[model samples]
Target: MTVTDFDFICQILRQRSGLVLGNDKAYLLESRLLPVARKYKLASFEDLVRLIRVKSDEAVIKDVVEAMTTNESFFFRDTKPFDQFKQIVLPTLMAARPNKQIRIWSAAASSGQECYSLAMILSEMAAQLSGWKIEILGTDLSTEILDRAREGIYSQFEAQRGLPINLLVKYFTQVGDRWQINQKIRSMVQYKEFNLLNDPRSLGKFDVVFCRNVLIYFDQPTKAKILNNIAGLMPNDGYLFLGGAETVLGITDKFQLLAGQRGVYGLTTGQAAPATKPAAPGALRA
Candidate 1:
């Protein structure tokens, strides 16, 4: 593709999704959107861009955006966060608000593995949380991924990644060569197509928010804006889990690192709560 075509496509992606695409990422655009181009019978990437520029078609635009948005995820993809969630965060929340309902938001919940992982944890602790109401909301920017998330099926390899043998046996049923998460676990979570850059306050407040591995895509200002927006939708003591490589430091003062809880952040003082350091990567098993 020409420089002009690449620049135009990159601009559209950033405007719509807050994804920063440097000049070096030409290969990414080509690889990811090639299917969209071919499906539309466009002769080349240039043809795709030409059609996009002229028609500004909603379907075409949506396809392009979804294709470009990264959806890489796995069951309990990173270990520490889930460990902190089950051992500390969940218990703390339960004790802090006994007899109250609890909600979790997996903001970048691609394909639902993260949300389902959470469901499995909650299910394991069902006896402890018996009388309380709980729900997991998995939101993504791609409707295509959300649809698959709702289906809750995984390939054999997908089922194995970061998933323990016992839990797998208990929670999934084999269908042909794939595994389908049981209805009991699937029922605990809801999937929605949502954009983080947009206002999410209408969804109501959450007790914990998992926006892991998502903010790395945005520029600083956009990152802070999204962080502040998330803060607005969480309670004063709500928990936030970022990716292993992500942190609220140097980004926003809205959240403080929870003491001794690696990858787990809480509200700061006054508007927020105290936060501790996160654990080292790969410290906890899934």
Candidate 2:
């Protein structure tokens, strides 16, 4: 990757996916995207970068972006959070919205792990949820990842990460070397391409939004913008979950911190109702 082309690609990625890449990350890019290069039959990273810039090839760009997006997740990744969701969040939502209809958005649903995991959770409680309208929409910025997500297949190694043995046996079948998620579980969620930096109006509202492990890539301004944009798409009393390390305070004042949790935040009682903020700031400035 030449310095000029690298900078150009980095700028475009930063704009499109909020990925902050610097010159020093050239090696990281090579290490992470070389598989992409191999899969696409490009001879080298230089060849991949050349095709990306000169041709402005959308497929190649999608491959590069998909290669860079973080997909670190597992079934029931964090134990306590799921416990909180089942014990507290679901009950609150059921009471708050008597219709039993709930919409969940996994903002950076890389390869669909998080969304599928949540689907499994909901399915286990399906008996009590028979009357509800449940919709799970998972969105990522990468076309390549979304394709894999739609397939709902995982290798033994991939399935081993955070998946429990019992659930694995029940929800998957061994095909060749990889473990495939069952069709019933796979069909529970809808995957789509969504750039958080872009307008989110048409994506609709959600009762709970899972946007974990992706915010650190954004600069503070971009982080605030993404946060505020997500808050806007959430119901007033809706719940928002960030990565355990992420926070809404000091970044954006749109969400009030939950009583006893660090990463969990929610809108004020009447804030999400025909809401108006301090004239919502710019993405970077928000």
lDDT winner among the candidates? 1
Q: So what's the TM-score on candidate 2?
A: 0.87
Question: Residues 1-286, candidate 2, lDDT per residue (tens digit)?
Answer: 6787678768878876889986799888788878888888988887877777678877777777877877776766666556556656776788788777999999989888888888888888889888988899999887778898998888788887777777788888998999889999999999999888888879999888888888988889999998888878887788888888788768998887666655567886532322112122221111
Q: Candidate 2: lDDT of 12?
A: 74
Best by the TM-score measure: 1
Off by over 4 Å in 2: 35-42, 269-286
Across 38-143, the per-residue lDDT of candidate 1 in tens digits comes to 9899978888999998999989999999999999999987777887887777777887886568999999899999999999888888899888899899999899
Error of 1 at 108 (Å): 1.2
